[model samples]
Target: MSRIQQRVAEAKAAGKKLLVAYIVNGDPQPEVTLPTMHEMVAKGVDVIELGVPFSDPMAEGPVIQKGHERALVHHTSLKGTLELVKQFRQTNDKTPIVLMGYANPVERFGYQAFATAAADVGVDGLLTVDLPPEEVVILKDALDAVGLDNIFLLAPTTTVARAQKIAEHASGFLYYVSLKGVTGAGHLDVEDVKSKLAAFGQLTDLPVCVGFGIKDPTTAKAVAQLADGVVVGSVLVEKMGSLEGQPAAAIATAVGEIIGGMRAAIDSL
Candidate 1:
């Protein structure tokens, strides 16, 4: 089974909800994003979703947009992030790494080559923001050939038919966008997220991970009650403003401490 599936299954068996964390690759540069990715897994993160920095991020909010800006200033690219993952797998291969970003860059890199490189680097899955279910076939088939999961996102505004289609094609898990706006917007209505989770549950058996706008332990816990998994990004990246030396983004640092506390909150429920 995929690490993602195994994680969700174990969470289900243990009566716990999975905690998925997202971070932009090369935020402080490849040197930093690499170690930070490892730290996240070592500290109790169930899965890692690394964002491939893009020029025009339609789905990203100001925070992640800022991340892309910083990462770009360091001159990081898809090749760099995958290389980081290649270096990452030298010691650890069990932790799931899903590259989340836009489709233009992937296509620009050649779909087949991208798949082969991701598999070669030990990447477990992908979540391309602008790649819809229909357009996914070109890359999805290539990914499947390499044994990589093509994870997709479903939004609150998505139609039931669209949701089913996305779920049907989804491999690792279904990333359910919690709200209508960009990531780190504001005030996520738990009831709205719960309603969306119910909708995804009706469509597929894939582990549903709720992301975007999850701010703290209380919010994460509330969403976990309905979601099979929870993904937080903006906050963790925010924790590293104006710092040096790995920026404390390692999963074992302050970010991990917060996630540890959030996990506690989920456990408390």
Candidate 2:
């Protein structure tokens, strides 16, 4: 089984839900990336979605967009993101790392070469934001060849037919965008999310992870009750951004404490 599937299965077996955390790599600064990563995992993050900084991140909100801008200022390329994963692996190997970004960098890096290098650097999955299901066969084949899962997003407006197509193509876990708008936007109705998750349960056995507007422990707990996993991106990134220019230990404490509360809430479910 893929590492993602294994981790989800382990969470299921333990009667606990998975807590997936998202962070823009090289955000705030390049040197802060690895420390934040290790700290998130140490606190409660089961899966790490390390976002590759991109110029045109359509799906991202203002917080992540600013983060991307900061990362780009450091010239954080796709290759540099892979190297960060390699450096992260030097100390930690159990936590699954998923490169989350747009397709331009991966395309520039070449499908086959990106797959091989990602696998070599201990990356467990890829979540290309703008890549559609119909266009993922080549990338999927490349990823499958190297044992990396290709994760996909399903929005609130996705039709049943499209959802099925996504379920068919997606591995790791399917990310369900809870709100219709972009990331970090407010207004996440838990009842609507619950209904959508119920509908998705009928279509695929793959674990469903809900993201977008999941900004706090209460919201995380509510989402966890309905889905197999909860993903909090914008808020955490915002917190990290707030802690910029501080000591690494301070950032770790602030971020860890915030996510630790989230972990506790999810576990409380």
Candidate 3:
């Protein structure tokens, strides 16, 4: 199993729901990224979805869009993000790091070269927001060769047939975009999500993780009960955005507290 798959399996065996935290790498500043990563893991994040900033992040809401903008000011490229992951791996190796972003950067870096560098730097998975399974052959094949997980997203509007096709290509875990709108938009309908998850469970045994619209411990706990994992993103990114001029340790602590609360709530299950 890849690091991501192993981490998810361990959480399942222990009767615990995974808490995956998402943050834009080099947000506010490049120097703060590594410390914040370590702090999040210490606060109980099972998996780290480190977003590589792209000029046009179509799936992200205003909050995360601004995060990408801030990171871009510091010139956070895909190469720079990988360097952050390498630095993160120096002191910590167990927590799975999944690079989440657009396809352009990976393509610019070259598929095979990007995958090899990512795996060498301890990256566990890739979730290219715009890369659908149909067009994922070159990238997915590269990741497969490097033993890295190729993660995919399934939206609320996805047809049963489409989801089945996506499940066929997805590994590590499938990220279920909880909101019909962009990330950080809309409120979650717990019953609707529950029903959808039940239907998805019939299609594949792979762990299904819910993201987008999970903003607090209450929502985190609620989603934890239905899915194998709960992914909290926007709220944390919003926090990071608000603390732009603050010290790195303070920023890390602030975000860590959010994860800590959600962790407590998930563990309470």
Per-residue alpha-carbon lDDT of candidate 1 for residues 1-269, written as tens digits (9 for 90 to 100): 87777777888899887888888887755567766767777667888899899999898888888888878888888998899888888988778889999999999999999999999988999899888888888998999899899998888899888898788899888988889899998878998888767767988878888999998999998898888878989987776434434544453376667667777887888
Identify the runs in model 1 with alpha carbons over 4 angstroms from their true place: 242-252
The Cα RMSD of model 3 versus the native structure comes to 0.7
Task: Check candidate 1 and list the clashing pairs.
Answer: 39-251, 40-251
Which model, 2 or 3, shows the larger lDDT? Answer: 3
Better of 1 and 3 by lDDT: 3
What's the residue-level lDDT of 214 in candidate 2? 92
Best by TM-score: 3
Tens-place lDDT per residue, model 2, 1-269, is 76788788889999999999998888778888888889898898999999999999998989999889988999999999999999999998788999999998999999999999999999999999888987888899999899899899999899888899999998889999999989999869999999888998789988999999998899999999999999988987898888877877777678888889999999997
Best by lDDT: 3
Order of candidate numbers by lDDT, starting with the best:
3, 2, 1
lDDT values, one for every candidate: 0.83, 0.91, 0.93
Model 3 regions lying over 4 Å from their true place: none
Q: Residue 28 of candidate 2: its Cα lDDT?
A: 79
lDDT of 3 by residue, 148-191 (tens): 99889999899889999999999989999887989999789989
